[model samples]
Target chain A: MKFKAFLTENGVILLEKRFLPALDKMGKICHLFLTREHAFFLHNLLSGDGVQSIAQFHKEALFDDYRISSQNEDRIAFAIDISLLNRAVRSSVSICSELGGGGSTANRLQIKLVKKLPPNSTLPTPFLTFETKGYKSAVIQDVPISKPLSRTQVLELQTALDMAQDLPQTLVQVPDLNQLQNFVDRMKHVGDLLNVSISKYGDLHVQTSTTLITLGAEFRKLLVIGEQAFAPPEDQTFSAQTRSERAILRGDAQSVQVNVKHFSKSLQCHLAKPDCAFYGIAPQGACLTVIFQFFIPGTRQTDKSISLHCRLPVLDPS
Target chain B: MSSSAVDAEAPDLVCQLDNVQGMVDALSSVRWKRNQDAVIELSEHGIVFIVEETGCLQAKVYLQRELFTQYEFRAHGRPRFGVSLGLFVDCLNSFSVPGHSSFIEIRYPGPDMKLLLKSVDSLDSCIYAEVRTRIPDSISWDYNFEPAGSTPLTFTVKSAALKEAVDDLEWPGSNIQIKLQPAPPAVTFRGEGHGDLQIDLMYYVNTDLLVAFHCDRQVSYRYKYKFLRATTSNIPNSVIKDNRGSKLSIGRGGMLKVQHLVSVARSSTPHPHIDSAGYQQSSRIAYIEFFVKPEEDEDAVND
Candidate 1:
């Protein structure tokens, strides 16, 4: 197996400084899947509990000279501590930036897989080494990673990732994350689980209840993605047949109950500076999916280079 | 009364406050421990929350009728109920968004005797909460603090300075000694543990720091540092922001009473009537009082 890549300046700033730090807060370890087309950070994919997060980045988005060759269809997957990787990247970026000064993009950051003996150990260990070349000197950071998965194990992971990508039938955009975070923080004190309901008519209702009290918040008039937003005007009069048909068109609201902690952890994605977020729930689904959409800076177009989303495991209603 | 007649009558108590943050601050001042039960009594004048710690420490938070934009009480008599202080405060805090001043409507006897709270100011979203309340038990201890003498030995200091001084004295100390003397007109707080630390607030030293000093004789008393710390530990930021002063007075038998006033007026938009009214009634304020019994061994004396 062989993997080597040079990170672009924008990639270093976003991936190392923003994306990885945000993902680090969500989980301890994540699988770094490398392929010719893209790189994916998969969290909690093999675990049965906790939130599952998938952050995808196209090869060109983060790397200029990317090359990877492996036995199993040129694909490689391994688990590594997110914080350790983040720290290595941060140190490399800071050292390079310091040596190159602010304006000069002369510093080059290269990452490659290497097997070397770690200090205080005789046996060789696999590490993802970050080599930052400056004008005068170079700094290398070694981040330990798990042994690569076998071809069968890689196939199993690919299957899990494919299954986890099942999108909900309807998706509705949520309000500002800061506002939602403030509201969810308060709900956390009320109950352990949160009931999230998304309607086709563009309404999101979040409710938390205990035997003593019930607290709920409703955000209405939200834009429904891929569907026309609708609200019956007060002055309009609808016939019985039309009203029933309209109701059918609106569809039923999908409801899911999820752990409050898992939901809150997903909201930390705001650090990635996504332009907008969409929330959806499948009909009688066991999970709630949140999609973070980023737009290209200084333009209205969506950034196709990166795609990030998470699935929060739902609790048994019974 | 028939069930229909009871249903026809308005809720036992319904009140609306333009800014719920004030109520949240006042209640949080007395919430020192988790899952602490607070007894709430509603009268025509307003609402009073009473929380007691064992039989030694008692705190009361008074929210007057004027504090609310609308206060309606149709019950035959004052109603009292007990609820978790932490839960109630947290629920109120949820209704308050950081930048937006949301009006909250509160109603009692909601369906199954739950306290209903709903935010009415947001057009995009509405937050509603129901908190369960239980029958209030008889108060364990109620001390009618009689003046120590003809003139009560009281001193008022800036809330911010007082909080700082009290917080600073939290070293290795079990008891704090408070001494007040009229000769130099000063109040001294001394905490002795690993070493001795004394903080003096003299009337003539910095009049701004010591807002008021009314002591006719020298009085000395000792109080548990923990109980004393509780009085200033949670003085809300609103109180300090207003530059209000906290009044500490010594009653008979060395009973200490500390009072703090928290302004509940809406900061976002001032009502027209607020300007017409005089300074005192212009803005509504919540009153918080804490009563602490001095240590038994230390005989408080008039020197």
Candidate 2:
């Protein structure tokens, strides 16, 4: 099997776009588990970056094509050093710039890889070809891909937010991503928990309070894309909606508590690509699924869009 | 200047400024290399906060008098006192809103008194943070480098290149041997562990790195990697001011001196109180100098 992708002059842009989201925030090292249809990069450590809070970053175009040798549908996992890759690509591209051949329209990267023997003796030597109309250069690096990373305990996601489609929900389109980022930045140190409440009238209220002071931000005229009517649990409440989802639909106000720092860090993805949609659903605990649709820069031919799924875990407010 | 001034004017030294955020950043930068408690020396030149680790490694941040908006030190002699760096930092940051500025009034009320700070945030509310200070015992910490008797070797290096080089050389050994000369092979850094790892960069060959090399005599010394490593992060995070680079100086006893202009932490506003030297004299600009003495092992190679 082979893997490859064409990228712009500076390899860093492509590197951050594809691998940064999939890998954990703090420590970029992760084990890539390949399946028949998609590849899963399982990060064993808690990333300092908000990616950990963002349960996962799911995408379809992980690799152009990653075929398995064992079977058509085989599972193989191998540990990869993301920082090393980041460093190597960074150094290599800088060399191109130092040599006076980079940052020009003629500069481009062509990567091609072939898996090594013994399932994974190590990754095969990858080919790095830097070509311009007048000059061409290449560098070959034998990256060391080792055994799968092992973990003591793994938190199995009880329920994926996307799987609960039947639950009543609402989608809010954030036209300006910077507004949310500014709020998170301001309220980052205010409290431990960031409480987000959504009202039926399409109002979004973000608040955090301490014994000393309380800070809140309100956004009005948020379009409530859609909501389905549902009944509350019989034992939950008689006069009001029975289930939490019903209350959320009726605009009784659905709120969720999450680590402020993580939520703020997770919003960093929006900085790279601002146009995003917030999908909110109220189960026993509320959850936010941010869908980021961004373009792969320098691929002027296709204008193909890449979709990234960042799921945040909502804590049950006591 | 009254010898028996009013009680309000009885402070050993009181400095007022429209902002104390600059001092806050200068204090925080040394935390990476020094101890939680630092000795602040108020002298004729300026105020120096010294952070030392086991007396072998030390970092000094010099806040010249020009940095303060209102400066006056009226004491019979230079006063050296100690306080918890953490508490002092907390006091400095108490009333600061993320990006905006705050007013600060700092005072040291004679010896054996507390370090009192008064600040007013944007809301016009006032807050106070008092940290008890102590008359430090008669422990001598020398702040002088390149003494009167000895000449020093110095060079200018691109900040980014030094950071990259340090990163490449880190973890290879417990100590790093540096060689500088007025001849060819301008700079050489060798880490002798896990197989010999040496990097030789010529002045003209690696012009992107060495930047400028100046030396009157050949100087080679072996400094403890642990001490030298502390300066690693300071390079990359150091904001390149006025397009100038970090300065490196080697003196007698193999004491490595690294001086850089560190941009004040957090605040993006341009520093105030410009100095003719082109080096900014605001809290936004800090003059940081690191001194790492060579390990005193009698058997350190050529020693």
Candidate 3:
């Protein structure tokens, strides 16, 4: 009926502030499923960041993360106003800091939740409590969650088109966030869509054209993530094999045409994350994927990797 | 004339903090959209940020002297002045550059003084910024709350508990009605908007939440959820870390007061729930208070 947990304060903060806000920008509501070992944020807003955006967390990527007093096979799902969660989290963080939380001193942040209240209905209760034994402080927050969606739909757009032959994209690492900012400024006047062309040699071109003028910036020497990274694990079909082969057979350029606004929004990841990896996913299919990894200075381990797939409406060029 | 003579005003007060991020983070918590400009009052204690919303809601945050490494105060009349909160928050947030050792110094000598902000970056480079000041008006409203015995309702609960309640009921309603009773359903909150929500908190039943309870008579009032939500938005659910949360007071007229201990390093308390301030285990003791006015002239009690 009930379970209590001691989760990492930093993980909770990251969920509330960063991940939730990112989802809110894409849509009004999101579905969060929490299990003993994992938390998943699933949303299908055609996120200007792309077609689908999913942020997941396994316990290891968490800060001193652990689960307690719970039965196996327990999962909770609820639809919530992502923006409201943003505010709720801010409230929790400030309260914790004021009382000397988020430190080694008060190591434990105890959170307990009950599935049913008044001992009857199947519906969950309205509140959850976050407490720390070291400080003997407990924060009981109303779990502002709502009824789950009728059906949890998986919105991953599985495409038959290949990233290597059909897209022939280039991968680039952003050295500075300002560069992305400048790209966005150029995009404002460029038209509704951006034409991103990447050559096999890593010459990445971001081009925008209006009725009168066309602006393009070519970045050279951008480090490309190894081919194996993009290869789908099971079949490993059209990954490093076809990508290098096509470049050698003919000097071909892979380009993906995506909404200028969506591409720019994805670039925003540069502000919160130190490094950004931009991948041109589907040129003809109209999708761009970006993955961000974060490091907190001297921290030994890191957690979840956020992958954003921004899909533009596909066009048939016969 | 030396450069100092050209700017003859020697700053009135100056303060240095080992980390400016903490101070900025403190201010960032109260960045509610409905809030107007704030007044920075300086004294022997430290700086207190006053944020008021439409005159109906007010949150005063007091960051004590112990928070800063270096502190100095010098004023003409009262040690307080007004500034644009947006600009103030921006100046504080500029320390986001990574790996940069942000050694921050803030100063202003006297009235009509340009607020000076100087900081050392990670590379030992110094950055200086100046912002024009707004004239300090006599505190537009009097905060002089009623003295001692006249008070009617008061109790303490974990800030987390109250904040969660406010947050849970925030949606689907423009106004939130709070009903605090002496009976079994000690606290009831109703939210009415696109959809309505009614949640009841039993005094002894919700054991982990209600830290202390004292209610003599049944009292109820309605407030704009937008305004009420702003008060709890910045509160950290657990301020003292011990089970003790924050204090809530309701006067006869429906002016709700929320007092929270923002910082506490001292641990001199047998009952964290009962006492507002106890033995100090927390080095920093910042207290933030919010006064919210209830909706008046209501015909219908239930939506």
Candidate 4:
């Protein structure tokens, strides 16, 4: 696969010309120059497909807002469009790696602009789309999900969307209350393994306390159960036994009733695939793990043993 | 077991048997006499009599008061069986309170035997009033015994005055029975001067809250009972000959004293099975002193 990197007004614009290793072996090359006029031509040429063309698709123009100058030597145009670049391919491309990065190691530069190419156009000769064509995939529909998106692609796509923007938008759309409620309910069913093992994707908006998660679905599929997990020995005084602890997702079954025992407790969430919203990593997973540091009241310590368990459905479609 | 033989010479002995028979017969009849005497005086008010006759027909009467404390009883008798006595004291117009009377009902197993005493309003019927105006000090008694040939003999009796209050009974004037029910133990006399006296008797009664038994032991000493603190002091018996190992020695100060016997002492004061925080309070305050067999070495006074 071929990538073009060049300096522009804003800083640098790196374009992934071809994304398949096999296509790179076949000598596929991308030749879009880093220039504004070339970006405009590319935008107009493929503007009429089901694909979204973001480079010259002016939002500010319709909103009567000022236009900013393109940062790169060329308006770095990009698209999920494999058809248009068919003419550029020398041979069929086979896809391998799963992650996408800003720039290669030799070229440690940040991308400052982005555009989408139109769909269904033939691959330009000397450039090729990977025949295997598998990256992270997501399914979107008009219905507001009552549950979180349990799949990995939801987070992957949301993160990619942020990185795809020339400037990350400070205001992101949050999932509705019904969606969060459903997600929370569904979270009770996922097993402990899935609850702590899966990855999560989150987005932060400028003006809200709610962290909008794009792929909180995996967490929604898990439930947290059991009493607070870390307690001192039975002989320790409540004051002497003071320590922060988290709840275990698997122990006893989760009861529907709110336990008076669990009042005044909180946990820090660490989702595997973090975005601006929940961008901490202690454990990696499509799952979410949290460390609940609770200042439990002294009267509650006892010889009593508590266990909790949660049921997790396998989200793998296979 | 058979009442066939008797000393024919002593007619008084025959009469004594007759009086005993009368008393037993009267008891079987369940006859209780109300105020039948107005001025008759007595000491050592002996009530419950237990009779066991074999070698010596022993008749033990539990006395509430001492031998010198006077009481007004309406009965006259020459006791028949061997007499073993108990005593109790009932005070009239105590502390000069017009209606406040204190009565001590005692049983005599020992001088330390705690009697059951109850105090109520002067208007309450169950309290028997002791008329202190008529008889203040104690009285002496002389005993005469009599035996009957076969049938029990009845003797005509007389006393100075009929006691106005019987058993210290009180009642609303409306319920007061003027006539004696079952014609109380006949106050009969052959003499003309012995007549029933009519007086505005304030009270007449008999009752108990808790029963007590007689106890007699070597620890015959003065005890001051209190609702709060009880005090005890012993008067030295200089005359008591020291019988080596026969009896224990008294404490120093010949007059050994026990003070600060509080009814509601601080829970910290020693007692068996009392937890510091778990002590319970009693409704009424009472202090009592009694000589119990010394359980601990320290409990006994060291001479």
**Segments of candidate 3 deviating more than 4 angstroms:** A1-318, B1-10, B96-101, B110-112, B120-123, B147-152, B193-195, B236-244, B263-281, B298-303
lDDT of 3: 0.57
Q: Indicate whether candidate 3 or candidate 4 has the larger lDDT.
A: 3
Best model per DockQ: 1
Off by over 4 Å in 2: A1-318, B1-9, B18-21, B33-35, B110-112, B121-123, B140-143, B147-151, B235-243, B263-285, B298-303
> What are the runs in model 4 whose C-alpha is more than 4 Å off?
A1-73, A81-182, A185-272, A275-318, B1-303
Model 4, residue A161: what's the lDDT? 33
- Tell me the tens digit of each residue's lDDT in model 4 across A1-318: 122332221211111231222122212221222222222112111222111111221222111112224333213323222223332221111111232322333222212222223257563222211222223532111111112122342334334333322221111122232333232333222111111121111221110001111111211112222211222233122110011101113321111111111110101011111111111112111111122111122553421111111111122222
Question: Model 4 captures what fraction of native contacts?
Answer: 0.00
lDDT of 1 by residue, A1-318 (tens): 999998888888888867998899789999999988999999998886899999999999898899999989999999999999988888887898689646455678899998999889998998999998788888888999999988998998899899888888778888899888888988888788787877777777788878877787877778887544465663024322233235445555667789988888899888888899999875467689999999999987899999899999989743
DockQ scores of the candidates: 0.41, 0.02, 0.01, 0.00
State candidate 2's TM-score: 0.46
Residue B54 in model 2: lDDT: 68
Cα miss at B38, model 4 (Å)? 92
**In candidate 4 chain A, where is summed lDDT lowest over 10 consecutive residues?**
A263-272
Q: What lDDT tens digits, residue by residue, belong to model 2 across residues A1-318?
A: 334444444234545554454343523666554445544444432342233322232223533323443332244445567666555556556665655764564444444344444354564532222222324555544455664323321122112222422333665555456656665675665457767665454545555555433344444346565653332334122211112234455656577877777566566666344344564544555454455555445533422333344545666644
In angstroms, give how far residue A148 of model 3 lies from its true place.
51
Q: Write down the TM-score for model 1.
A: 0.91
- Root-mean-square deviation of every model: 4.5, 14.7, 20.8, 40.8
Best by TM-score: 1
Ranking by lDDT: 1, 3, 2, 4
TM-scores of chain A across the candidates, in order, are 0.91, 0.61, 0.67, 0.17
